[model samples]
Target chain A: MKKIISVLLAAAMAFALAACGGAQSSAPASSAPAASSAAPGQSSSVAAYATSLDDIKVKGELVIGLDDTFAPMGFRDENGDLVGFDIDLATAVCEVLGVKPVFQPIDWDAKELELSTGKIDCIWNGMSITPEREQSMSLSNAYLNNKIIIMTNKGVTIASKDDLANYNLGTQADSSALEVVKGDPIYDSIKDKLTEYKTYDQVIMDMQAGRIDAMIVDEVLGQYKNTQLGNVFEVAPVDFGEDLYAIGLRKSDTELTDAINAAMKTCIDSGTAAEISTKWFGSDIMVK
Target chain B: MNLSYIATLMPALMQGLAQTLKLFALTLIFSLPLGLVFTLGSISRVPPLRWVSRIYIWIFRGTPLMLQLFFIYYGLPFMGLTFDRFPAAVLTFVLNYAAYFAEIYRAGIQSIDRGQHEAAKTLGFTPWQTMRYIIIPQTVSRVIPPVCNETITLVKDTALVTAIGVGELLKAAQGAVNRDVNITAYAVAALIYLAITFVMTMAYERLERYFSRHQKKEG
Candidate 1:
């Protein structure tokens, strides 16, 4: 009987992985286009703009879209298990909302389309707030604080933002860091030296290999990478200003926007958010 | 480069390789026969059948495989059609490869001497018999080398499945790199891919020699 139970558990995990986050009761974080009890076409086509709390309740699950490759946020761990700060926080929020949280891994580039088309009800990843995002999507109130900071290989010194002019710099294209840097006067000083990669991982890799002298990245991801790589790089003395992380929902889903924000408030008030945050990041990083 | 870190990654890498091998094997099984059907369609006397096959070949072959994957997996959902991740990936790969295979088979068919057809006709054999006995067998041997090239390309193309969020060998390696913040996993992945292709190439060479042996003896 024990052997059978273990086999069943294994089967469930494999199904969760294969279905791309199908509803596996055990691992609340299932993988991609989960055939949710919600009738896909009926929900999107018939209602059009009525993705309210009731509709999600009828479906009985919150289909969250995320880029699974993002570490320290919604990424897989060393054991190939999906566990991160956002994943745990979302799970807590889902418990409060009384629905299972189904994590659907998505192409990060197409996240907005995924939201607009009703494929996923929300983008619950560690997405940062930017002017364009605020303009395009209905967003929750700030849940966590982050900063876009410059980091450099240990031997490379950058005493200030201007000191970056002496070194080769890199940041992810289309990332909030790039947005912040571009808007800063210092951007002009480092424009010739700046290179943009598709992901921070590549920048980290290049820095470890000694090709890039410095890279601009967010606090959670950059610090996580530094810790994992055994402090290959140190935070440069200068950084872009503070940034906030929030949940992204479709513009018409104002009802869900309010519901999620309320649930988040509940999670914060009860100290559950702090507990989960501490578990992942070693402290309460959630904005009180 | 920690030997221990790569050891820790083995289970996940093996799982990813299983997904890649499944996609590669299923694509070949479906596309090879599907290509023959398309080859027959393109050569049909009816213009509609020939045009349909030609256009399909043109569209699937001319467009990028990654685009087709996105269209089927993500794009089609908006239109009320949805597929699971693995099937969507397999569907895209099979259609894309079949088109390429169809063209290769068509070329092989056309390359046969017209004199052989005339000889088969003179011997009272029907056109169907001529194609079945005289054309296809010879074409199979002729197309093996090109087909092997496509197979090797298909092995690498499995990496594109990651775009649609399906885990495969390359994604596994990238996952490890992100988790460990190290590049050693990538070097190990490259070596594993090289090992797979090396085995596949040697197998294809053996199959090729077996198919073309008679021609070699004559030469």
Candidate 2:
């Protein structure tokens, strides 16, 4: 009887601990800034530029939103904490601006709400700058140039974009590739024939097992997956469209835009961006 | 905040609610029998059959449902199997919950007395007949509460299916939160879940009363 009671108690304790562990796992974002600041010269003089970017500088922090599952760009680590290339970039940008960075994991499709209501001061993921998106948000200069490539099973015979015409292409719904396929003139004939999924991971699985002909995804991601999948998949260099990675700021905050552009330039000159890109992507894919 | 936004979204949410209901309804229809088959296999006199059923139960019950969901939706296609989002979500849920329900059914069936089986045998009934007419009726009564509890859990567990992108209630709520950045939308979503759960609880109570009605009469 005592043994049975103890076994039940152990099971109950294990369950309680699991529940607590799951609940405490928050998205790993940079911690909020201290209520005070270090003395002058301890860090770069952010005060000189404070009057220019006063709205966010006065707030003493920038809330940056991203979908943390995108790798070589942004993703959660084993600890369930958000960490990746975009995370490193955001940290560096915040350090230069002398503001704290708070990370919020926003669904990719809902970035508009994450920005407009000030839940995040900016969108700093591998956000592609497009003509339509320019109408809604202010953007910095193109920080990196990327194009969508065809990731396919090695034995499948896709060599170029035209070779993929009749085949069903898999891409995440609402992603740049999906958008281009739906709206752009290039893919019009084949748009209706495509299968868009919620996650490209699902599509990649299909491609691996020959369920689909190819997956349309960013070139960098395609490279990462090719390396991970070993020789099972082949990446076609032929691309559907040029996707430029840029920082998205609210249209109302031109000062923040100018500030971020300056930081981008500094990071480029200092080789910080290239170093971070190498750390994650294993090569410097940074735009000059 | 506007009536029009609510008006537009209410229809969409309702459409999603229908899918949620379909997934919920079909999972019960399929898994209930599947659970019984599993129960029988697990309790069978044959060692290999019993062992296979035990391992199936152990694996499904031991892993995180989210990991199981991802493995099915993402990992399965690598092995050359592809299921549509709705079917994939439903299949995973049924397979997962069936394993859990099997254990509950087995416990209830095993709880019946050895004398009951012998009594049925003395009355010239075959072994299968004894199990069908004698063992199953009582087991049904014993397992109803646990089965209902699982169904309620299934309703919530269905939300994890969003990883495969079925656009169920919680995903809709996420869409709302992504656009607004307020907790009110999340709160409203929680209320929707609460409403579903409450209705199920009441229905389960009615079922328990209906089944135990015979016991009350005998008393």
Give candidate 1's error at residue B55 in angstroms.
2.0
Best by lDDT: 1
| Residue A2 C-alpha lDDT in model 2 | 71
- Record all residue pairs in model 2 with backbone atoms less than 3 Å apart, i.e. clashing: A28-A82
- Chain B TM-score for all candidates, comma-separated: 0.97, 0.93
True-vs-predicted CA distance for residue B117, candidate 1, Å = 1.2
Which window of 10 residues has the lowest lDDT sum in candidate 1 chain A? A22-31
Give the number of the best model, judged by DockQ.
Answer: 1
* A1-288 per-residue lDDT for model 1 (tens digits): 976875576455544553542222112111122221122232234246447889888989999998888888887766778878899999999899999999987867666656765678999888888877776678999999888888888888889887989998888876888888888998888999999887888887777678889998898888998888778688877788887999988777888999999999999999999998888789888998
- lDDT for model 1, please: 0.82
lDDT (tens digit, per residue) of candidate 2 on B1-219: 565545444544565567778899999999899988999998887755776677678667987786666556544543456576678788888899889999999999999999999999899999889889889988887899999989998988877766554657666555443332223445666778899999999998998898888788999
Please give the lDDT score for candidate 2: 0.70
